[model samples]
Target: MVSAPTNLPSALAAALAERGHEVVVHTRRVDPDAPERQRLPSGVVVQQIVAGPVRPIVEQELAPWLGEFGRALAAAWRDDRPDVVHAFSWASGLAASAARQQLRESTLIRNGAAAAPLPVVLTFTAFGAEQHRRQGPVDPGLANRIRLEVALARSVAAVIAGSDDEVEELARMGVPRERVTLVPPGVDVSRFTPYGPSAERTDAPRLVAVGDLTPSSGFDTVIAALRGLPGVELVIAGTTSGDASEELERLRAGAEQLELADRVTFAHSAVRDPAARSALLRSADAVVCVPWHGPVGAGPVLEAMACGIPVVATAVGAVSDVVVDGVTGVQAPPRRPDQLATVIRGLLGDPVRCLGFGAAGADRARSRYEWARIAVDAERAYRALVPAALPAVDDELIHSNE
Candidate 1:
């Protein structure tokens, strides 16, 4: 697996490793003094490739060094080649593609015939064209990034989409639908559960919104929804203490302007600590996620569902697929605070309905969105690309363990 160091990729690598696959994660060497290779407790190997300056940098800025990173990967894998290379994000896909090409060229020179390019499966967390369409080319590197992303998608063996909306987006970008697979992101079911201790809250109904407090995050819509539901308090969990980003400031000012300063609490600690995040989700009457663009904000929504909390989300991306409307949760059009408020009010007013949604949500989350199931889905995609590469599963052993 190739990706920048992040929670989702790390969890996925660990899950794959636990499922008896030899997982090796390759990432750029961000810290000057960090080891080039380290083994995680989950038995996954982390190999940091030297690309540019050994310091932290954003993905957009890191693009220039991807070629060098690819060369390093090619050298490292010359002898110990992985059967399947799964890349997360556009940057990783570019590097994986380059490395595969490099290996193929090397084989052609060394042998009589050209060796087959290593099979690579890519998962784009968000598409560049989608973002450019929604937010414009705000980042200077965005245009070039979009071009590279489209080419990379075309070159990859397969593309794993996190949502149905993303699959459609990929098709519009000229990627064949047969090469795309829909595998929604997963949650840690054991950590997030209905039985866990909930965070302290007032008797008034509560709504929790989790994610970065950017303009596109739709947190302002959440605050607006509070205006309609008088006694309801809104908890926004994302920022850390002492970090004064402009977006966080804007959200605070907006909340104050709407006279919801007391009603809206920015829980800085909840996003950093897993225990606190789970507790906050458990305390929520419903978790709200209404990002204007981007892949379904899977982290917050899936985690909330796993905790058996009813979700009140925008009918965007794979959210509808995850949260069954009027069953597991309620869905409203994006940016419509009135509709969001109405849905929240309806869900909160009927405790029986809320309980039913929570129960159904918990069942859905456990059955479909757990990490174990997600790993299986991923493995299937990998095997489809290169069936002989992965080890065959032993059904008798699985049954014995169960």
Candidate 2:
């Protein structure tokens, strides 16, 4: 079940369905007139469960609507129960748990036999602890979110963590180590490749940074680093024009203050289109990802690598795992502009090293980060629970490249 607005859930659903699994996605109603059940072009079933208003609400505001959402899920699964209930976030996990409990109770009351419970698999995009550490105690909802995440982690059959850092964090929060699996998010290798057309660039070298235009995103560090590298231009591709207008202004103001306004370009519309985003990556001489926290995942870094562009990312989250320092790309500490600049200067100065890193990065991305490969890993996780819930037949049907 996808409880948030992130793209990962739908992408994963599509990938899983492509592997011949019967995937049904449950999400809250965003349009009042839309049908309750719909099918995507990829043939995945999507059920828009009624909970609250059709209007969009923040993730924190979703707490009050969960009961209704869970009931709706239970109703949908009453006639046909799925072997595994995979939830994409903490909110989804809570709703899935409630629905499973309701199903179990109904089965027990009807037949007087204990039905084998539906196993729920969970994946948390970002843990509350990481948020608390980054945003600090000023956030009022942080405590409650952390507590609920801990409880949900313990309740789920399996937890897929995007990074080794996340696995350690879950262990510190009291979740068993055995229950957590390390599965980094995948990238679309076919779309993001070196063969694609790149975004327009000047004769000067370019460094592209992609993420939300927030203070913690560390775009400022890139801007600061640009001051030292005189000839190179930087393109920070995020913060679409209308959305986050304030942040857009803030970043522009920072660039102006540093007297490097002409050198930096903000590609506002690049993120909304896959082709444009891939083009932007291909245009980059090197991609710089220096977010202050681990929640950024390895998305931009991996996409950049997939495009055969060298990366200079902070050693946080799965990015640290994906980028091999001095091999595929360079890794640096977060919030360090001087150190980041030094590496960028070195990388941009040597064309042979840049080509080497880019080639290696593309190889790693194709070999390890493909969507099909990730779907297989997820299928294995689902198969682990299926034997206890359903009859097992043949194992030869499944194959693995990892």
Candidate 3:
């Protein structure tokens, strides 16, 4: 269960569907007027459990909708039971836990026993400490969010931690080591292949960054970094066109102030399509991902690596784990434009090193962060709780039938 369509849950669901699992995503209906069920391109089924009008998940007012949402979930899952219900946020976990309890109670009283309590798994995308550290003071809902996350970790069959740091947090939360699984969020490597640096881009090297135009994202640092490399152009992707958001203006102002108007290009619309985003990443000579310290595997970095493009990312969260310094990609300190500029310049200067980083990154991404492997890992965790979840093929029966 998730509040809305987030990159992590949506990607995992699609990957799981591709792995032959019947993936049904349960989430809130952001569009009150639109259909509740959406069939996405990757063949995952989505069912929205609408509590009320659309609201952001992080807002404090969302707390009142929990009970209603849980009932909706219970109703949705009654006939079509899921082998494992994986909740993607603290609020979603609360709803899932309550719904699961309700289902169990009803099953026990109505039938002889409950159909072995559905192995509920969880993924808290951000650690509270990391959140506080990155943004300074925490939100009003943060303390409760952290508490709920800990409770979910203790209750769930397994926790899908994107980084090893999360596993440590789970241990501190008193969640058993056996129940925590280090399954980093993955990227689809098929479409994101390195088309070997663009043949058309002969004028100057280009660096691309994917995400929204926000202050905390550290795009200003990229703009600052681009000042030194006059030849290198920085492409900022994810903001929509014709909207005067202050964040966007601030970035524009920063570029102007830094005298980088010609060097920085803002692709004002988010390339939501994977193929398009992959194409954008593939077109670039290198990708820069220097967001403030946050959750692991925020999508762009892994996608860039998968596309066989070298990345210069800050050493935080999963970026630290995935990028092997000089091997796969370069790492810089968060909020440091000088280091980022130096690394970017170094990569742009040496085509061989950039290609090597791309090649190595592609190899690492394919071997360790493939969706098939991640799905199998998730399935294994589910199997630990529900041993009969996946049945083995009967080779003898097939042979006899043949």
Candidate 4:
């Protein structure tokens, strides 16, 4: 498995390893002092590779390093040729496909573009639009990033999309339907399920929002909604990287302006570290995740449902597919603070109704979004791409100089 060492990729790698697969993780960063080899319970072997930083390298330096990295990956593949190679994001997919070509192996690519338009462009455009609306026109690095994504997408053999929306987007960008597969992200229901009675909380109907403090995530919108309602505390969890500092500050200011500084508490920590995050979610009355523009994956929503917490999220992207409004949870219009506030308040006022939604959410999560089912689907796809065994061919030397 080749992917960036991000949250989703790490989780997927662990899940794949747990399924009795010999997983070799190719990452962009690996500390030299760290353990050289760590064995998983199912005997998976993880191999880490530091591909160097993309930010500091100039175009001239970048091209050469990428070529060298490609050569190294090719050499590794030739040494231990696997049945199939799975690449996780567009960039990694491009690199993995190039390496696979050298080793003559089949490749499977998974889309980790959480939001539509790629990460850099999405962030720049979102921040630019917000800044432009408030001040004036600004130069957003959107066009360049879109061009890069289009180029990268064209090079992959098969693109595994996280949702139908992503498939449609990839299709519009010239990727054929046959090349695209809709595979929604799955949650480990066994780890996230609400097994016992709901935990007790002292606060007046706590509502939680978990994700990075970025503009696209719209945690600010949740804060805005919280301002409209009294006796409701909104807990915002998740750490922000350098790019999101400005947005985080802006949200803090907004909370202060709305007199919700005391009501809204910001927890600059990860919402994925099982123990801490599970405890936080279990104590919540409801969970709210409203992203402005997203084919939102199964992170916050799934975790909340697993903890038997009703969710109120924006009806954008895959959220509607996850939360079956009124049954599992509630859905509000994207960017509409009033609607979000109303839904949150309703859930808080009626504990019994909220409990019913939570129970339904838990049931849906366990039934449909289990990681075992997802892993089987992925393994099936990998098997379909590779034949049962190889046939010996004539010893003919062929060379291409194109």
Can you write out model 2's per-residue Cα lDDT over 200-294, one digit (the tens) per residue?
Answer: 88899999997666777799999999877989899988643235878888989999999999999988676888899999889889999888776
The full ranking of all candidates by TM-score, starting with the best, is 2, 1, 3, 4
TM-score of each: 0.93, 0.94, 0.87, 0.81
TM-score pick, better of 1 and 3: 1
Model 4 alpha-carbon miss at residue 240, Å: 4.3
Give candidate 3 regions above 4 Å deviation. 1-3, 38-43, 54-60, 111-115, 196-202, 238-244, 268-270, 296-298, 389-402
Q: Can you tell me which runs of candidate 4 are displaced by over 4 Å?
A: 53-64, 104-145, 196-201, 239-243, 270-272, 390-402
What number of backbone clashes does candidate 3 have, counting pairs of residues 3 or more apart or in separate chains? 1
Q: For model 1, how does the per-residue alpha-carbon lDDT over 167-277 read when each residue is reduced to its tens digit? A: 888898899999998888888999999998999999988899865556776888999888889999999986422344887888889899999999998886667888989
Q: Write the per-residue lDDT of candidate 3 for residues 1-63, one digit (tens) a residue.
A: 444444236666666676666677777765677567877898777776777667435434567
Name every residue pair that clashes in candidate 1.
none
lDDT of each: 0.80, 0.80, 0.72, 0.62
Model 2 misplaced regions, further than 4 Å: 138-140, 239-243, 388-402
**Once superposed on the true structure, which residue ranges of model 1 sit more than 4 Å away at CA?**
137-140, 239-244, 387-402
- Using TM-score as the measure, the top candidate is 2
lDDT of 1: 0.80
